[model samples]
Target chain A: MKIHENCEILSLYIDGRLDPSLKKEVDVHLLSCAECREITDRMKAAGKMLSSLEPLTAPPCLEKDVMDSLESRRSFSFIRMAPAAALFMLLVILVSYSLILPGKRNEKLTSGQNLLENEGTPPAVSGDGLPGAGSLKAPEGTSAKATTEEEERLVSGRNLMARIDNDDIKAELKDRPADRVPAASSAPALKVEEMKRCETEQGVREPEERVGMDAAGKKERPDTGASSTREKMGDMKVENRESEERMLPYISSPSKSKAALPEAEPALAGTKESGSPSPLVISNRKDFTMLWNLQNASGGLTCKLPDIDFNRQMVIAIPSNAGKTGYYIVDTVEKEDGIVVQYREMPIRDPAPTPYQIRVVNRKPGVELQKVE
Target chain B: MEKKALFEGIVREEKDKVFNLAYRLCGDFHQAHDITQETFMRAYGSFERFEGRSQLFTYLYRIACNVWKNSLRKKSFSSFTSYRLDDREIDPPAREPSPYESMRSEDRCRMVQKCLDSLPARERAIIVLRDIEGRTYEEIASILGCRLGTVKSRLARARKSLSEKVLPFMEVAGK
Candidate 1:
């Protein structure tokens, strides 16, 4: 074996790990090689020096320290989990708060929906045609007890509208002179004239002739009519026909003041010509909010109602077609003569009633309806 | 309670051997105490898994080797330099100056420990286990989790490295 190889094995040789034959070979090499002999002697001396180190005694406090650490670790496990518990509790509170907010919104929406459903009943209008004592006539097939409950809900809704209107009038009266303020008796008359202009611009046929034509058409195409009114008002203008189908005839409430009754006649006559209808013009925030909530609850096509300054802007709501489904306002074009509302009717799988379509317009005189195929 | 008592007895019996091994490996008295405590704590934690395949001290020596290796890694370079510096300040002086033989022995022990500390942790452990602790080659292999051939080769290299560091010191001391 080479001197280098012998040097490498020198440590193992001192530790007695080498075979007797290899040890004999190294022993023979060591006898002759001075470099290998010196290296082996030094390595043996180093081993002896390491072996002579005194064994150290362990400190007395070791066991106590370790036991204390283990005990503390066991006791504080709950403290380690505190953050996760806090985060879980926060998540639960957020979920419940989200759930409860929608529930309250749904309650307000439910009451508004009840008011809309009872629209078939004629409103007992006061002589001035403002929100009067609400007396609603139940539709056919509804029980009297259900009618009374519906009447009470409608009365509460009307009372809210009356309070809003009174507040608006008081604010208006404060801003204007007594002479410039329009008479309460002439308000319905102006509304009638506006309806007439709308009908003329839209080319709606007279209500009686359209009703006759609808009756004949229902006989020929039995499936075309989905309601009694649809069977009775075929090919009529949708706005006028649906208005007649859904709205109650405006009749004077049993009030002692007969002076304003005569002024409301022109409005009643216009209703007969155009078809019986509710007030389509929403002029206050309270009315718009109620309508907006009702629209959201009905789960139909939703419109983006612009933020309207009520003094300058109004919303004209086209009566919903209760007999047919899948009709929604596509857009509104404001023209010099009048505002033209364009609507689209798509075929739907389920034959559910269409929802009301409203347009935010400048508080102008007239609005015409147009259907887009 | 029985397991605790049994482990305490084991700690009592093995502490001196474990401490001596640690002292030779780290070349620091306080570090040896800490390493011994950590080894017994680890051994007690894993006592249920001991299975008694080899002797209990062999298992504990393996754990001590691992603990020492981990401490070497966790210690920063600056902290290691500081430990070397602190070694001079903390090492106890020989009590009896009149006894020249005892003083010479203590000086030789410090020189040998300083040379052992200069080697790599793995080589230092090998030298400490084989030369200082007097473990057999097979038992060293079991403690280090290496082959018998690897143990023999490593011990040879470790002893050679230790000789290189200690021989210069020995020459100075002789002069």
Candidate 2:
């Protein structure tokens, strides 16, 4: 801040060379000192004089001169830089698509084989035609993994998870057919009215009231052991593929009315009458439990149903087998009030996990899915 | 659609400021214009690297300063370009006409500029940018890649020296 120090910093001060702190000092000093003030004024005029000395313009041939110089050179063009980012994004998308989408051929083969092998009938769709042509929908049965190749593709896996749940019930029901026909498997040493009521509730025909009853009319014989149950199941004819496929559209649709629930009801009722306590028991070893939860404060669906329960449009699939897997879909809203269930138990293939994409459409109220106990 | 369109648009808009700054720093109309065109060409070549970090003007200013500085070097005009009258040449001609009334306004302006051309290249450059162009010290600092203090001090000395050379002429020109 002294005069000698101020003078050394002064020259730069006029030229904008002094730091702000030092410049502030000079500004304050120059305000009070006539000599330094005169010096500051003159320095400012000198700088201005130099700048206004010449007004410059680009020569007429400047662009031509530049272009002619540049004609022989290469690599400074604009197109070179833009393509890298675009190519990278495109590659990520193609890789994801390849990973996710499986061929139709494999899917059909899986469903076809499931029909041939899985013997357990699905949950009973009881209606007016008791045990007639009503088809069974096993919820949680997929045997597709025997042929599943590992990549990273996702199909409608939540539906597949629901089907797995139905299949578990089918496996349980198969081992204990009596569970399907509770009354016949139970003793019938009681009143006729009581027996008729039990039969009606179960959609079973009373053995005593039967006319034109052939094998369907045979009285229930209780079987305690697997061997005896096995004999009974062996004698019963397995429904052909055509019959199962023909009945699928009706039983699978959630929109079907309770009154018009597939006409195959009567025949299924007969199958139930003969089938014992869930002729199958789903063990925890082969038993895969799919726990699903999505982000909603008020309402959510847990796909732990006997069949694949697609009650809501946006569902999630957390296949323990396929860890952290999600399929992006703009789900169709529920067309009718009823729940839609599917039970295709031909070993369904677990989806490969390659093109697993999480495009978070961030909105004011974006839906979130997290793990729940 | 083509790359040239974007560059052309930039060139039309930014060429003047660039030319003026170059002219002020070099103190030669011919060299300043050349410097401006070369600055644009350099900018066009590296246009791909431009990621818009700062305003295009700031970038162009930095490029123009470098171009002017380099042209000074290429022409070996460093001694001439960087000379400060006090720091180097004081071509005093035995106390010229005492009235100081003989000089024209343009002669006074030229005399002041010729004296500024004597300062160090960077000091001369800073004076032209901050004092003459009335650029903010911060912008001058950024363009020259120096501290604000450097710009301030240099401008002060530059002004002081110019008036020493031209005040006699200014007093006359004003009368």
Candidate 3:
């Protein structure tokens, strides 16, 4: 580097500004170049003089004064921002809550309905009974579009049942037909076994027997009076309203079902006693009305079976002849272990009984009907 | 941490550097104190935005330079140079001095400060930052918000000018 060019390096070098390689280069250059040496010495002296200048001390009170001013300004700023922050937080909460509530309700409605389409049965109970109860729990086997009104009714009824004292419950259970108490004990397994039987029988049952087994079996059946099945159903509904108030207290737990199971067994064991071929058979559809004691007196058909206690009755009516139908229900019969309620495709309210459609609703949550395939 | 406590910590650590930069740039003790206060006040107002991209002292120095530059715009360089000769003789020799010796030292300091003030603002900033404040060229470039080459060239020009202006004083002292 020439004298003029080296002067830049000289100043940079004196200020420790040059890179090491350049500083060393300048150092070698300075040892030989008198003119560069003179310039470097002068630059060194000038840098020392300036760096030696005293640094000023800030006043002791300077920080306190500045901070006080800053605090006052910040308080004013916070006052301005407060309303906007509050409004933003409120909007976020409102938006989140609005978004969340319907999801919970829809979640309750949807979860179990899908299982009905897939499995054709009420969903099995999961741990939290409330959510599981909503699954496929519809009346008349129509899709589970149970109205909020029904939900509210179910909730209130459950609350009422919860209030029943244990003594009251036991007394109420005791008051039920002694034979029916064993049937209730046999309920869960009996339902499963009956459902399996019905599924098998559904394939083998002839069209004529499917219509009305009294016509096909040629067995005598007592005709239910008046052919006013609609009015009878209406009467049953009214009775259900009355009986549900009484039944709700006793039906909350499965302990009753387990207790009743052994008693129902002997009824099964005595199948030969009836000597009726299929001892559990209420195969004659006209005899179905005998299950509820709605048969005519003149017909001389006796409903001689011991009366049973149950939570609700399902009336399944299938069309048979024009404007005439057969009503079928789960018929409870004595069995070996206990009594069993058989759910078959029996017709009610119509004589033709074709297409084999059945409608059922058990208003009690705990006492769900076993789907016969 | 409370805003006051945070700001106080930064002030405690870098207050002298800020004050010295202000004093050196404007050559007025009162004005330097005022500028230092204003610099910290501005830093507090935007402290939330200070994302710590640079060192704290470097950031504070940038603010101090701007404050000093703004003060220069309001008052001319000649007025600042007039205040340069005072009781504050800038880290004078440690040995005790007679009145005449103190006066001579003050005169020399004033001469050096006058030479620094003669340079343009950009060059003056580089010289004060690099030569007086002993900041590296990279730091000088950062504080003045300029490229390293700009710091190098302007520093060279400021040094040339300073040497020319103070040469007569140095010669007189040499005799």
Measured against the true structure, the TM-scores of the candidates, in listed sequence, are 0.51, 0.36, 0.41
* CAPRI class assigned to model 2: acceptable
Specify the CAPRI tier of model 3: acceptable
For model 1, the stretches where C-alpha displacement exceeds 4 angstroms are A1-5, A31-35, A71-89, A96-373, B1-13, B33-55, B77-102, B145-147, B168-175
What TM-score, to 2 decimals, does candidate 2 have? Answer: 0.36
Q: Write the per-residue lDDT of candidate 2 for residues A278-343, one digit (tens) a residue.
A: 111111111112111110000122223233223312221112111122222211112132111111
Candidate 3 chain B: 10-residue stretch with minimal lDDT: B76-85
After superposition, the stretches of candidate 2 with alpha carbons farther than 4 Å from their true spots are: A3-32, A47-55, A72-373, B76-109
| Ordering by lDDT | 1, 3, 2
Predicted structure 3, TM vs. truth: 0.41
Runs of candidate 3 with Cα error greater than 4 angstroms are: A1-6, A16-25, A71-373, B73-105
Worst 10 residues of 3 chain A by lDDT: A184-193
Task: Tell me how far candidate 2 lies from the true structure as C-alpha RMSD in angstroms.
Answer: 21.6
Could you say which candidate leads in DockQ?
1
Output the lDDT of residue A196, model 1: 38
lDDT (10s digit) by residue, model 1, range A113-211:
344343433332322221222111111212222233323323222111111122222221122111111112111211122233333444432343233
lDDT for each residue of candidate 2 in B1-175, tens digit (9 for 90 to 100): 4666787777777776787677567766556656777788888788888889867987899999998887767874443444222322432122334445324433654566566667778877877776666678788888889897677667656555556767777676568
